[model samples]
Target: MRVLVTGAQGQVGYELLQRVPDGFAVFGYGSQDLDISNADQVRAVFKAVKPELVINAAAYTAVDKAESDAERAYAVNSDGVGLLAAAAENLGIPLLHISTDYVFSGDGDKPYTPEDVTHPTGVYGLSKLAGEKQLSEQCSRHLVLRTSWVFGAHGNNFVKTMLRLGSDRDTLSIVADQHGGPTSAGSIAETLWALASVFRRDGRLGWGVYHYSGAPACSWYDFAKEIFTQAADLGLLEKSPNVNAITTAEYPTPAKRPMWSVLDCEKLVDAHGLVPKNWVQELQTVLRQLGERQSV
Candidate 1:
């Protein structure tokens, strides 16, 4: 399979490139190499690559920045996805798209199912929801995998941020009111590949919106505490910082974060025999990788 992945420099994008299985040819492009928001660029890349499968990792992921930069957010998150769908549809191929948990209003208590009513409270979430709609409307064969709280060794994420803060500050304050699973980028990339392999064998997938996040949801405070513990154990941190639990009001941002971002991944498991990985274990792997990178 000739798979073309956008946002190649991103957390998940880098993993997608690195973990290409045998019998598959993967081509990855960063924002500079292939600007997904540009129609001409997207069309030209698709034409040149002649990809049999298209996995769109490109997105405007700056949540707080998207509040003030709605146009750019929609351009990449909404318009860019639509363009990819059009290109992939024209080629008669499957378009695998990544979406976020922010599509919800953050008021719900239980895990969000794929069929839950979407009510995004911020511009970023609104833009991503629009992208999901665009993909469904523009392409016939597509899978919109919605994930939450993505962190990884390859790019900027909560894990790296916490590690940086933990090393510099004696005490770190994290929002405890907000809760969600801290998904690993490598795990997400592998999940996409597993679907790609299935599609290669069967020539089709269950094909729809599905949720795949880390298991056992936790708050930002909880996530930070774990990061410090694992990082210190791995000798990545000199000493664990004192993590303080704080409310959302204590740390304000431009965008409204989901109070509850836990996603129900049963649909994916039932359809594809895929389940979410334990994030605590995944965190250990990430810390080890970060340690290796630091050594180099």
Candidate 2:
């Protein structure tokens, strides 16, 4: 099977490149290789590859910047996804699109199900929600996987930022009010591979919106503390900082974040028979990789 992975240099795409299963011909492309925002470019790449499956990991991911650059965000997240969905629909291939938990308004304490209403609070979330709507309307065979708090070895993420800050600063303050699962890009990529394998065998294995993330919800403060603790255990940190917990208002950004963006993974678990590892365990593995790379 031929699989095309977009945003190949991003965290999730990078992990996908490393974890591609055997018997599959994978073609990974970064934004420079094929910018999804350009319709012609997207079409040209799809025509050349003619992939059996397409996994779109590209997006305008800068949450705070999106506030000032709404146009670019919509062009990339919404229109770019529309182009891919159209191509996949024309080719009769299944398209797997990655989404985020930010699509919901984050008003409640309970986990959000797939059927929950989406009232995005920021430009980034609104753009992503538009993409999801387009995919549902334009493509029949597509899987939109919604995840949260993604971090991995490749690309800039919370884990790397926390490691850097913890090493440089004597003390750091993080928001404790915002709660969500910290998913590893490696885990999300592996789950996508499992779903793609099923699609390759039979084109009908429950194709729709699904939520998947690390087990056990946590706040940003808890996540940072865990990252520092793991880094110290792996001997990656020179000195750990005193991480203080604060409310979301204290640590403000340009965009408003969901206070409770945790997604329920029951649908994914029931259909794909998959459950992500705990966030702390994933953090340890990432720190271990970082240490190994530094040593080498």
Candidate 3:
């Protein structure tokens, strides 16, 4: 079957392009190639491709920057998703859209489930929630897969940032109070392909909102320290820098993040019998890919 993907240059989208699996035609469009916020362009692309399935990876993901650019964020995150959902619905195709864990208030004592009430603390989260609503209302068949803390070899994500900073600075401070999984984009892509395969085979698989992220949660400080450790062990760094743990208050940002962004993956396990990848183990692959790219 043919599939169309947007935001092909992003962390998750890049992974989707890299790992399309066999027997599936995957077509992708970057921001310059397709402006998702533009409804006419979205419809035109759908008309041209006429894909059997659509995976919308396009998003305005500048969480902190969304505070200053709510209009842009909503346009892409909210309106663009509606357009995609509607197009997929009209074409009688299935749509799988990526969402964020920031949809919750982040004060949950336990990990978040798909049915939990949403109360986004920042503009980015709020806009993403709006898109979720749009997709549910507009599409007949849709899969809203919500995830968190995505990192990859080819994106300006937390891991890449930490690697750059840790290599240059003697010491760096990361928020300890904040806890979540550092998910590898590669794992998410593979999961999507697996889900798609199941859907193709069954054509009546589970569909709706689901939560998936890296197994085991850790604070930002923990994730940073791990990055340094693995990088040094891989010879990417001569020595690991000092990672100082600090509270969120010590380092303020334009957007307020959910203190605990951990999401439960049991629902996905029940539906697809798939568990999330252990990020610690996957980090090695990411670092190796990045290191190889750098050497090239």
Give all TM-scores, in the order shown: 0.99, 0.98, 0.98
Residue-by-residue lDDT tens digits, candidate 3, 39-157: 88988898888899988889999999999999999999999999999989999988999999999999987899999989999999999999999999999899999999999998889
- Per-residue error (Å), model 1, residue 228: 0.4
Q: How many Å off is the CA of 150 in candidate 3?
A: 0.4
Candidate 2 global TM-score: 0.98
lDDT of 2: 0.92
Alpha-carbon local distance difference test for all models: 0.94, 0.92, 0.91
Over 4 Å off in model 3, which ranges?
Answer: none
Question: Model 3: how far is 74 from its true place, Å?
Answer: 0.3
lDDT of 1 by residue, 49-105 (tens): 999999999999999999999999999999999999999999999999999999999
lDDT of 3 at 186: 89
On a 0 to 1 TM-score scale, where does candidate 1 land against the true structure?
Answer: 0.99
Candidate with maximal lDDT: 1
Q: Which stretches of candidate 2 lie over 4 Å from their true place?
A: none
